[model samples]
Target: MSHYHYSADQLSQKQAYKFLTGAIAPRPIAWISTHNLETRVTNLAPFSFFTILSSRIPLVMLSVNRRPDGTPKDTARNLLAAQETKNETARTAGVIHIVTPELLSAMNQTAASLSFTDSELELLPDELQLLQEKDAPLAVENAKIRFNVRPFQHQLLTDRSDLPMTDIFYLEVTDFYFDETVFDAKREYILTEKLAPVARLAGNDYSHLGLLETLRRPD
Candidate 1:
């Protein structure tokens, strides 16, 4: 019957972040990749604040938070953002990938902070990366699951000078790419253990698939 409670308005930035991120343990991560047509360079980054907005229409959300210095990260900057278009079809597109255990090393490598002009994919060691020429710009070649996404709607969280700005993008999933090994075509369900998708914990922690049990609701 005893627990600590703090008011949101009273908490400091560090305290607020620590509580939010810590309480929301093991969140699914979105390993996003976008191409800057102008620079002819690719950008890849990971966001833990990701989830499905709608499944019937196929939409997913990825939130990109500004850095400690209050600057937008490369992915947010490159997200068909600079050249926004009115038409959804004409809008710039990118890929949202699901990280598996095998791709963990490469995924972590892409999370490094780099300049807008610099490409993060190139920073990975040869042993952890294997990108194909034709499929190179689309998505991470090593990831088992991916969503070809186009920006359906975008909103800026807030721009207060004292607080970090975050960009909220709801992407329409045009299609899904699943490696045959992890997909069950007949049943149309993924093999969770085989994929062993990675989840983000607070700070530098990550988690993989564990024991699973299905519970059914009474009809």
Candidate 2:
């Protein structure tokens, strides 16, 4: 057996990001949709640095990196603004849609670089519908599973130099929407085969759910 190791401190930011993304296999994608309160413009983007933090409170975490200009990304900014504002109705809430293989193309479209005034939803195919939820941001119409989430907390990650690098958000799920085709109401389990989730790999690579396996825990 052979092993190669590199110190993170020695690697450039770009190199470190490349290596980390390559080494981390099959990361789930969070197709986040947020709305700007002032512009009334909707923003959609994909991030793989996402995971469920606490099931009890239905909390999910999303980590976003700052832009090269040292500014918060649109999604992070919108979420933060939503949290600070004490409006009778949430003016900047969002929805996190679960990405599936079928929606990969549409999801990728949302990732394109666009002006803050522009909307990525317009680039999507006509078949892909965007539906408005009363007070929340628009939701992907046919997404098999989606979470109506609002910003719960925001944390800024900084380097030793005290330079902010990443923004981490803890979101609270207010509601859940699941498609009947993928979820079993009586069994309370998702039909994995039907869901066909796509996972992010290194670079432009992505993977589909491969061989399914199960391991039972000892009672």
Candidate 3:
């Protein structure tokens, strides 16, 4: 077999990102929705660098890459603003949804950058354009799974020269909504196969579940 290996220092930031994402098999997508409650402006987007930080405390983490202009993404800013505000009703909160293969196209469209005053909700598909109700995490009644998160910690990563690259949000999951089809009330378990989550790959590719496997660990 042939091999291709290069030092991290040899690549530019863009090159490094490309190579890293290309090799990182399948990463789950966090279809994040940040809302300005007063104006009802939503910043909906998808991020792949997301993972569970803690299961006991119900925490999650997602890294938002900065723009070419060195500005933090809207999702990052909205969550930060939410943390600072005293008003609970008006505070902007992050509502994270699960992505299925069928929703990939609509998810991509939400990735388009809009002005601070503009909203990405305008571009969402008809089914997902419902209004977000107060004290609701699912956004809509039929949503499969959604996590209502509050950002408690943020880490700004920088390069060698101190140039900022991404903002890492350590979010505390406040609540979760699981539809009946994907959840077991008595067992308190999520049905993964029914959820049908989609994952992000390199470039413009995405993948769904295939070939279930089960390998029990040794006791």
Best by TM-score: 2
- Give me the candidate number with maximum lDDT: 2
Clashes of 3: 0
lDDT digits (tens) for residues 85-165 of candidate 3: 744554227788888766777888988878878877778678754646575322533448888888768888986678887
Candidate 1: regions farther than 4 A off: 68-70, 80-83, 87-92, 128-136, 159-164
lDDT digits (tens) for residues 46-104 of candidate 1: 89999999988898988988776777777777664633855545433677889888778
Q: What is the TM-score of each candidate against the true structure?
A: 0.88, 0.96, 0.90
Task: Tell me the lDDT of model 1 at 14.
Answer: 91
Residue 164, candidate 2: alpha-carbon lDDT? 82
Ranking by TM-score: 2, 3, 1
C-alpha RMSD between model 2 and the true structure: 1.5
Question: What ranges in model 2 sit over 4 Å off?
Answer: 86-92
lDDT of 1: 0.78
Which pairs clash (backbone N, Cα, C closer than 3 Å) in model 3?
A: none
List clashing residue pairs in candidate 1: none
Per-residue lDDT for 57 in model 2?
89
- Please rank every candidate by lDDT, starting with the best: 2, 3, 1
